[model samples]
Target chain A: MEISTTKQFDLHRRMVRIRLFEEAAGRLAEANRLPGFLHLYVGEEAVASGVCGALNDDDHITSTHRGHGHLVAKGGDFNRMMAELMGKATGYCKGKGGSMHISDTSLGMLGANGIVGAGSPIAVGAAFANRYRGRGQVAVAFFGDGSTNIGAFHEAANMACALHLPIVFACENNEYGEFTPRHKTMAITDIVDRAAGYGMPGVIVDGMDVIAVHEAAVEAVERARQGGGPSLIEAKTYRYYNHHGIQNLGLKYRPDEEVATWKQRDPIFTFEDRMIENGVATREKVDEIWAELRQDIETAIQFADDSPYPTPDQIMVDVYTKSSTTIGTKS
Target chain B: MTRTASIVGMIVNPNAGKDIRRLVTPATHTSDVTKVGIVRRAIVAAFESGASKVLLMPDNHRLAERASDRIKGDIEVLDMPLSGSRFDTIAAAHVFCQAQVGAVIALGGDGTSRDVAIGWPDAPLIAISTGTNNVFPSAIDGTSAGAAAAFVASGAVCLSVVARRSKKVVVKIDDRDKSLDDLALVDLAFINSMFVGARAVRDPHTVHAVISCVATPASTGLSSIAGRIHPVGRWETGGVFVRLGAGGRKVRVPLAPGSFTTMEIAEVRRLGEGEKISLSGKTVLAFDGERDLPVSAFGTVTAHIEATGPLLIDVEQTLVLAAQALMFDETARHISEGNHVY
Candidate 1:
């Protein structure tokens, strides 16, 4: 697939946004400013930017624990997301759902699941809804390589195929599932092979290359939308940060050399070089986008800092529908 | 030899229930999570009622499409382009009309149903309320609504016998000699506000509501205001017109969930069918509690009651008709013969 300049620029812009947001989140978490656990999507930016770029705004996506990249790629507002991470009342879910559970249903973002493989079933249900309604829209499930071992993922994959649900199960194989590496948990090297067991097409893509991932996703998404069954895409990528916000713990698990090697093939820098080489954008224009993204992230952080926390009295509210008289009442 | 198959059109608005009310008032958020479950139940019920095929309106969130995953029936999504606007609903309705669907089941609030009505004025509709201000749509169980829709679709119950043409308030621009093709099925409120701020009738005092259909006391929004003053049954021939302010008798009404406000009724009158009432001023006219069109200063806009809205299926009545017709006798007998009867 030929990558147009507009598409390349957009992909770069989205990757920059996710990277900047993740970096800012890392800084905040390190300083103990954020209220909850932060999973930075630093090195795995290309997978989100590429896959989301291939989807329409109406298409649904169920994200994993490391979901900020997915949400941002899907056009989520940085201000509300930052506010949510800070547990502010103005955030998504009214601060009731923090970073791990942030969702903007208007954008077709199902929600960021905190539990491993939890989003798979939700994605299946979303795909099912799409099929039942006869809406030719596809649902994507973005889970980590570790989530492949979870039963929900297998069940969801099986159900999606049996029902011929229009869904794409995109696994970000970032080498490590929390502290343990991929080899330690799974026997197979490529997780996409498991799609065969579910009677669906499985393909592998270079997750570090945004163009490759986007091409793969476009094909998978189109197939599903056209009534073709689900497809599993295994994107080979690596994470620069540790499992959580704590960078120290990450260093203890992965060696410095492996991290350095992955950084050398960093998605952002490689994409920037490709853009310049392909005459898509100048180095200065790419630098400008990076600078603009930094400023945007700063504004979002400031907005989150200024936003107030949820009132103590609001704790019981939003638990259920207000139309129901039985809910939230002391009977 | 083949039998004629029944097809039901399903439209689920993902943007439904996520309005400014959640942020402005104490109303709880009705996310896509709840809508997915409702759509699932509706689809299953439609299949159970012998619907051979279902046409789902494609939406941004894929609410209906996702719900179709588990259903084993032939489901076709309307192949119309979507702009992620209300026009999508209108386009989908047009497709359903062209396809000559047995009935259309709309999962949304008043706005969604109104859009469907605009496309096919006489099409049979089963409106399930899923939005903030839900006066037009009924809060019936999804499964029952689906079953009723299927009954009509399958010709198990005739549409004319179990359905009624809804009442609507037609708006006409007097100076421009133009009339809005869209009709408000429940209440049309002429607000004193200059602009359509937030697209909701937030301040109840600024509303001068003219309802074409019945407004029950149990309903909410501007319809509730009319319902409080004079309760009109659904089968009533006329409507109620109320001028709201702080000068008349104070009546408490719920504008949104968990949010109630007291408003005064300056004038209340009965508006008979085909009766025209004119309003001249710079105001935002809200249809079914959703502020849509704006009239300039000194502009005259007339609202007339019309009994030509879409045919709405009464779920209970349709189910009763199905039972009376022994629609499920064959399946019951089959199960009994197989020794699986409960």
Candidate 2:
């Protein structure tokens, strides 16, 4: 997938943005500054960056619990994202949704769901709508390997294939399902095999390399957008932190050696090194990018801290209660 | 366990058949599932032939990990991080060389074998065909190839007599970095292009020249452009050199799957061992059908054939030698009274 130098720069920049954002959020969570659980996308940044790099600015995507990287790569505002994490009124959902539910309609990012496989149907539905409107917009559903076993995922695959919907099922196979190893819950080693039952073409790519992921995604996205029906892409990746937060719980779910091995293949650093070798950018440029993103995240944290909380009158503004009295509404 | 020759090294390329060529040509796409199945059969057969442990290259699809499921023997993955490029294969072969593995099984195309050769030139390789326009790999089944590999790895079948040491064409680019030095097992072609985009040489019109290590008659790909005119075999001491242009003899070559392109041949001849062929042009250097290093018009590249390559295992020959030694004889098995040496 012949990516120009400009696109290569964009890919690496987006990856660093995600890594920096996740690192800041992790620090906040560790310091007890954040309210809700933050599912950090630390080691799996390449999957989001590469998949989104192949997407158009107006293309739609449904994100999973570890969706911060997806939104950030899709051009989500840092200030609004940090505010949403702090539950401030200036957030993306006006403080109603935290990290897991953050979404920007302008960026065509559907809400990141807390449910494991719920994004599948939403992405499929969005693809159907896009096809109906004939705007040439493709929808990508980003989920984990564990979700491939879910009934919703299967149903979505079946419907997308049967209807020839313009959707791509992007599976970030991080080798675990929350606290459990994926092997314990699933029989198949490759999640791409699940797409075969629905007669959808499946592709497996290296999630640690942004170029590999972007190459595969470019083909799959093109295939879907050209009315070639849906395609499933499984990226073999790993998450650095525990599924929820940076603070390690007492429970040992995986081994240190495994974590150490994965850390050596850190997507952001590797891409920077690669870009330098390929003559795409200089080391100073890479360093500047990291510094800029770090400052941006810090500013975003301050913004979230300074923003006001939702007022009492706004408590029941977007929430539907269907009760006789409008709850939380002051006279 | 004491026979340091009990380990078999495996390199299964996940991206071999999955390339842009599939869209351009009617190439057979070898799904990761089918590759896993082939790996399973190969590893099991290696163990059955008395190999104690097997080491596999870790890939993105977890082909090694998946192939090792429920496998009784010690199926170890090389302790190395992946770069997700051709470097992964080279790194894995380097590890295998440091470990001094008995025999290595490569599951990919000519390009995959070439990568392994770069890491360990003296590797006892059993390269199985799993890519487009393959000439270095064999068409044998994984089971037989694995069994033969086990025989070689176990020192049961001697390499000196049964194995065929293949030939390779090494190219050194002057005015370029030392890393640009590369080799090809079958053929090295000069593609008339500036960038190595997509990696596959699809258009016959762009191929300017080819230098082949071993071009068997009736072969396909770049070698066939010369093979159809003058044949060369693995045991031969020399190579085939050809230049492509108009107003010359035209021959058909299957550059990809399900189709053929007739290429005009300007000149063809036998390239003797160590005979350096000079190439100076603005073109992409394609090693075994994969466009790798590019050359500028100011740089001069020299390519020559060498017998210093991998020791390719002869599956049928190794099995025949084993049968001759009563290793597969039922009478000998009965005489052993179920106290199997394996």
lDDT for model 1 comes to 0.80
Give lDDT per model, in order: 0.80, 0.84
- Give fnat (model 1): 0.00
The list of candidate 1 runs beyond 4 A from truth reads A1-331, B1-4, B174-180, B330-342
Looking at model 1 chain B, report the run of 10 residues with the lowest lDDT sum.
B333-342
Give the residue spans of candidate 2 off by over 4 A.
A248-261, A277-279, A287-295, A320-331, B1-105, B115-120, B131-133, B146-163, B171-182, B187-271, B277-303, B316-342
- Residue pairs in clash, model 2: none
> What docking grade does candidate 2 earn?
incorrect
* Consecutive 10-residue window with the lowest summed lDDT within model 2 chain B: B333-342
TM-score of 1: 0.51
